[model samples]
Target chain A: MDKFLCGIDLGGTKINTVIITNKGEMVSSYTLPTLAHEGPEKVIQRMKETVYKVLEDAKLDVSDLEGIGVASPGPLDAKKGIVLNPPNLPGWIDITLAKILEDEFKIPVKLQNDANCAALAEYYFGAGNRTKNFVYITISTGIGGGAIIDGKLYDGANSNAAEFGHASINFDGEKCQCGSYGCFEMYASGTALANFAAKEIEKGRESVIKDIAKDGKITAKDVFEAYKMGDNLAKELIEREAFYLGVGIANIIMNYNPEVIALGGGVANGFDILYPIMIKTVEERCYKASFEGCKIVKAKLGQNSGAIGAAVLNIVFSKN
Target chain B: MDKFLCGIDLGGTKINTVIITNKGEMVSSYTLPTLAHEGPEKVIQRMKETVYKVLEDAKLDVSDLEGIGVASPGPLDAKKGIVLNPPNLPGWIDITLAKILEDEFKIPVKLQNDANCAALAEYYFGAGNRTKNFVYITISTGIGGGAIIDGKLYDGANSNAAEFGHASINFDGEKCQCGSYGCFEMYASGTALANFAAKEIEKGRESVIKDIAKDGKITAKDVFEAYKMGDNLAKELIEREAFYLGVGIANIIMNYNPEVIALGGGVANGFDILYPIMIKTVEERCYKASFEGCKIVKAKLGQNSGAIGAAVLNIVFSKN
Candidate 1:
């Protein structure tokens, strides 16, 4: 009999649930707004609803699942399956979501940080396939990453390995929210890109970015839109973004020396366009030998990476 | 009979060789000037002479040895036993020192980068003892490091893992020889400290450092001496050096999250003086959870780390 696995990607804005074959073939999936402002109870209730609906739509019972995995923003206790306080998911303090889900469904459950899950997803089914040393980086509102060393997730003391976002790129530069000066995320993330665009326009620089941002609140996506229209300011911002990403990636190469670095998330959606410039910067910053040994590519799983990796956690870790 | 292992630390200015029991008890040691300008052939001959002297002093023969381990500056091919163009040892391109030793001794030989060897030595007998996740950082004329992941040395894809010195701390800052801008070494190394002091003196800041360097060739040691004499310039330079180290170490914490970060090398001779400020900066930069989970300390082995680690390489890897 074929075993099915259930995965739940818990986010600040939504809950994503999926029931898939052990091989990652999606049988049924469901998504719903979290309405998290209503509190943990309401959000978890929605999460459970999606899980049950996904199972039902797949014509499967709770017993059919190998196990359930939950991927969420961390500082959480992976071993205890508790969600620690995450900046994105405000007020989500020490909630045992894994236990809550397990008790309700009467099935086993596991939990891990979303970055680690995404890394696992890529290693098993995406750009990291067949590579023993791998790293997955997500450049969304913030930068974060997970490393796979010798074919296993490198969960550093307290599951905090590969928090590359907080690593500073400028010792005397901008102060970051994390109490660091010029952190990688502060320079290269989508939020940083948008903030840079806004700061530039505020300086009276001419650009389509301001015109495109009708309500006057510019987004990183707006910069990309303007870039397509041949706006010089937009082009400059994107180029700098690529350069910053390269700088951070070069540091990552120094740290892990992985065989492959798979980039995912919001900014990485522009990966193909950014790759050449980004790689050129990397080549300039690192040893020819180290850079040549690695293959940098766009992450394949995209938005579903977290859910897919979450689903595989119990399957991979338990079997080991 | 106890199994005996031999280790050699090949460096730009010197060659250090050691004989140790499998349990890491030292039996004999020898050192020789490298005179690297004379090239690889002469350097290798001296290396062989040291090996013979160490064995003779220990009252052991080549037949009684387990295997030989050679630790050198990298860009070398460890698997192929070839020394590939290390900048410190000029003209050392593709020299098969390991094979030459093996052929002469009729015993197995192993090779690794010196930084990795130091990490392994620390892991086996120094500050990293009983720790699974460890990192050893050496801050000298330049900075370098090696990581132990899940109780084993992480060699990465091409023996270049943990080259943390090259990682940029400021994307728009001073250019480094490695082509990166504002590398950790460019700001925090012993050489960097001396250079900063020289620059400050050139700007006409009054200090005992000028008197200490009678030949007008400033050294990091002179700055430390000036610091003891309460030289204001030296004090400021030391503080900034500590600050730069803190910034780099903060990034290291983000990248590896090791339980222990044992700092070694020339700059680290003053680790106690630098530690408090460095840790304070790290505390200010990283999350409370991660900071609490790690223990930072001065490396225990000091200069002998590389040679000791080289001796244990074959023991650790082959036994596994």
Candidate 2:
């Protein structure tokens, strides 16, 4: 009998669960709305249901599973597998999802921050497999990052190592939610793009984004659409965001000299639109020799990266 | 018979050579004027003389030496042991110092950037021995840096991995010699401090630094002395420098999450004066959990760090 593992990508809006073979090929999968506002117990119940559904779909018994791995938004305690008030899932203070899953399934469980999971997936299956050192950055509702050094995840002293978003790009640029000024995320995240678009609309800068958002609630998608329609204001806004993103990414490159930099998350969907400009700015700014030929590539696995990464964690940990 | 190594720390003004056991116990040492203006051949001859003197003082023959390591300023090629147009050593372009030394003594020789050697010395004998990942920064006329990962030096794609000095702290703040703006070295180096002091003096700010530098050749040492005597302008200058330094260092910590940060070089001599303020700024700026318990320590071995690190390169390369 092939050993199997269950993986969960726990997001604020949804729960995605998968059953995979030891090689990390997904055998079956299930998805459900998180209904996180219903609180931790309800979310946990939904998560448990999804895991069982995935196993049943694969025609496997619970006894066939070797372990379960969870990837969640963090400010979490991975050692204890507790999610400590992740910003996206408000009121989720110290939810021990891993321990509860282990209890319900009678199997070992592992937990990691979602960004770290994405990095693991990229390391094993995406752009980073060719190098031992790299950084993975996900730009969406908020920016998140993870690092790989000498072929292992660098979790820092408290398992909070790769806070690349909080690396300040400007000392006095803008205020961040983390009570810092000029964080890279403050200027380059999807939220920042939306905010910039909304501010431009408020200033009566004529743009096609207004037509895309008839309700006047501008989003990053609206901005991208407007840019595609040749809206000068939207193009300028995206160019500014890409400039900051490029500078921030260049800073990471200069500091770490990673062999590759993997871009992931929702904003990466616009990678083709944004990457050329980002590369141009980085080339103009970063040290020439170190960054030359350093690959900047979009993440391959998309929505499944977190779940796949989580599944691989069991394999990685067992080998270690 | 015990195996021994030779180290040469070649500086613009001086040359220091030492003979030591493989265990790092110094057996004999000697120092002499570099006379770098005398050109490459004479400097190489002087370096050979210093090495011979140190060995003679220890009563050891060339046969006793396993190898030699030379540490010099770069843009040199470490792989081929060539010093390529280092700014301080004018006209010394593409000189293969390592090959020259090896030919004279019939022992293998290795070359490394001076800052990298200092980092290696710290890793082997100073604050860094306890951890495999760390960054060593030397704040002198110009800032220089090295990285230690997995208990070994990382030379990057072009042997320039640890250009910590060139990493941008502010993307648009000040112009740097490397054709970038707001590099960490532009704002935090000893050269930057002196430049700031001179600009302040030019603006007619009242400070004792002007009195100390009767010839108007202000230096970082003058700025420190004035601050020590409670000159308000000097205090403000130091504060600004510390803030930029903290920003840069915090960026490094956030990106690499190194276990320790070792400060070295001439400006590090005043670390006692700068420590409290530097730590305060770093704590306020960096991610709290990632930096907690991460040490900011003074580099041991002082002036000998480069030479000691150079000696160790023989062992490091041999193992590789």
Candidate 3:
């Protein structure tokens, strides 16, 4: 009987479930809206249904499954497999997701932060493959990151390491939601770009974003679209955002000196505009010797990175 | 026969040598002026002499010695054991210190950056003992740092990881010597304090620093002394410096989430004045859960940390 595994990538708005063979070949996968307003129990019930659905579609019995993994937004305890008050997920206090799933499926279950899962996915199958040490950063609605050191996830003293987005790049720049000032996410994340465009438009700055927004509420996509059309304000805002992103990357280089830095997420994927300037700034700012020959590249895995990484967690730990 | 080890801490102004038993008992130690103006060849010769002297004083011979370790200021390659243009060691470029010493003594040699040595020493014998992960920061003329992850030193791809002082906290604040803007060292280091005071005096501001500095050039020590006497300007300056220090510490917590953060060096030792304010700022900025139970304490080992750590390098690697 060939063994199979399951992975769940859980977020506030959605849940992704995947079933794969032990060798990492995907058998089946599915996505579902979380309906978080219905509370943790309901969401968890939906997750169980998704897992069963994936297993059934792959024509695999529950007995063929070896383990399960979950990638969750966290400030949670990975060891205890508990979800504790992540900012993205509301009404989830101390839910022990791992134990619940383990009991439900009668198999081992592992829990890791979403950023860490993304990093692990990159390390094994994406841009950071074969690198002993690397930093994986995701620049979506908010910035999230993880570090792989010596080929293993670095779960800091309290299992809350690699909070890269919260590392303040400007101590006096602006108040952040995380209680810090000028966090990289506040200046360079997709939400940050949208927020900046909205604020500027509210202040009566002339720009095409007003037309793109339709209802006068700008989005990061609108800003990018405006930049593509040669809007002067959009160009300036993006330049400023790129400068801060570069600073954040430079800071990571100085602090971690990882073998590779793989950038992913929606904002980073605006490569035609952001990648060139961000790379140039990093080269100009980081130590010459350290940056020389160091690889700074786009992440290879797309939306599936989180689910695949989550699934691989059991494989990695079993090998260890 | 019992084995012995030798450690050399080489700096711009001085050289410290020590001989210890395999079990880490100090047998003999000595310090001498570096005489760096004599060039690398001469300095290497002096280092050889110092090692021999320590062995002789400890009543040991070449047959009893296991290996030697040297900790030096970096920009050097630890893997290659070469010194490559450290800022403090002017005119010394691409000096193969480890190979030369190993060839001379016919024993293995290990080379590490001074800050890393300090972190290693602290890991085994100081504040970070028994802590699986920690960050060691030195706040002297400039900031320096190293990290110990999973009970081993984390030397990134180029062996330049944990250049904490160079991590920028302000992207557009001020230009740094390393061609970056607003480095943490530029805001929180002792040199930064002295420079700030000098600039204020140059601006013709009213301050007791003018009286404290007979030569019209203020030092960090001079500012501290004036603050003790209740000078308003000194108080304001110290407050600003403490705020930046707190910001740096907060950033470290967010980025690494280490179990402990050990602070050392001249500026950090002035704890009676800086600790309260610095702690307050850090608590106000960092994620409350991550900071909980995390020890932010003074480094246990003093000036000898570098020498001791260097000697422990070979022992650590040999065991591995």
Q: Write the per-residue lDDT of candidate 3 for residues A1-320, one digit (tens) a residue.
A: 66887889998789999987766677999999988888899999999998999988998877887788899988889888999988777789999999999899998999999989889888888899859998999999899888999998887866677788999998887898888888989988999999988888889999998999967778788888999999999998898878778989998898889989998888867766887788888887788876884788889887877887888888878876
Higher-ranked by TM-score: 1 or 3: 1
Give the proportion of true interface contacts each model preserves, from 0 to 1. Answer: 0.91, 0.52, 0.76
Q: List the residue pairs that clash in candidate 1.
A: A169-B169
lDDT of each: 0.91, 0.84, 0.87
lDDT (Cα) of model 3? 0.87
Q: How close is candidate 2 to the true structure, as a TM-score?
A: 0.92
Each candidate's chain A: what TM-score?
0.98, 0.96, 0.96
How are the candidates ranked when ordered by lDDT, highest leading?
1, 3, 2
DockQ of every model listed?
0.86, 0.55, 0.75
Model 2: how far is B211 from its true place, Å?
1.3
After superposition, the stretches of candidate 3 with alpha carbons farther than 4 Å from their true spots are: B204-217
Best by lDDT: 1
lDDT for A316 (candidate 3): 79
Candidate 1 residue runs with Cα over 4 Å from true position = none
lDDT of 1 at B233: 96
i-RMSD of model 2 (Å, 1 decimal): 1.9
Give me the candidate number with maximum TM-score: 1
